[model samples]
Target: MSAAIWLGRFLFALVWGALLANLVWPFPGKGFALFLILLFVLLAIHLLQLLMFASAYRHFVQWRRGDYWQIVVFGIVGWFAILNAQPQREQELKR
Candidate 1:
């Protein structure tokens, strides 16, 4: 996946991790109830985000099928690959 996509996944994982940790961290008492509520809320938000992701993927796939996104995706991927590959290239050149 793209860097942005990977980073987004990392951040989302952090969110989920925090939510789960909240239940146990900072003591376990009345906050547990609040945490339960928060967990449910997070679940709802997570579901919505998943739906949105699915919807976006569906549209993107459709666009790809039409060849409308090929250039854009290629350019973005090329840009990221080149930018990130520079350090490796320098190392290889040194070797």
Candidate 2:
């Protein structure tokens, strides 16, 4: 994987880890509220990305459960990774 993708995955893991930590120990006041807002916003953006690309994905790719999870966590970067990983023949078929 590229460094950018690895960085994105690292950041996503940090955010998820923070949320999980908050659930266990909890953050105080505005911090907790902010974390919740961040979580929801991220989820909404990821969901929109998935929906926007759903048709193209269904047509051109054979996706697994992990692919969906990657999209959820890494968003558009994940989508592009999947696209770039496709065989050259499959990519040409889109043209």
TM-score of each: 0.40, 0.76
Q: Provide the RMSD of all predictions against the true structure, rounded to 1 decimal.
A: 11.5, 4.0
Clashing pairs in 1: none
What is the Cα-based TM-score of model 2?
0.76
Angstrom error at residue 7, model 1: 6.3
Question: Could you give candidate 2's per-residue lDDT for residues 24-81 as a string of tens digits?
Answer: 7779988888887887888899988887777666876866567787788789888867
Give me candidate 1's TM-score against the actual structure: 0.40
Segments in model 2 whose C-alpha atoms lie over 4 Å from true places: 88-95
- Which portions of model 1 show Cα errors greater than 4 Å? 1-14, 22-26, 62-95
On the 0 to 100 scale, the lDDT of residue 17 in model 2 is: 89
Pairs of residues clashing in candidate 2: none
Q: Cα lDDT of all candidates, in order?
A: 0.51, 0.77
Q: Judged by lDDT against the true structure, how good is candidate 1?
A: 0.51
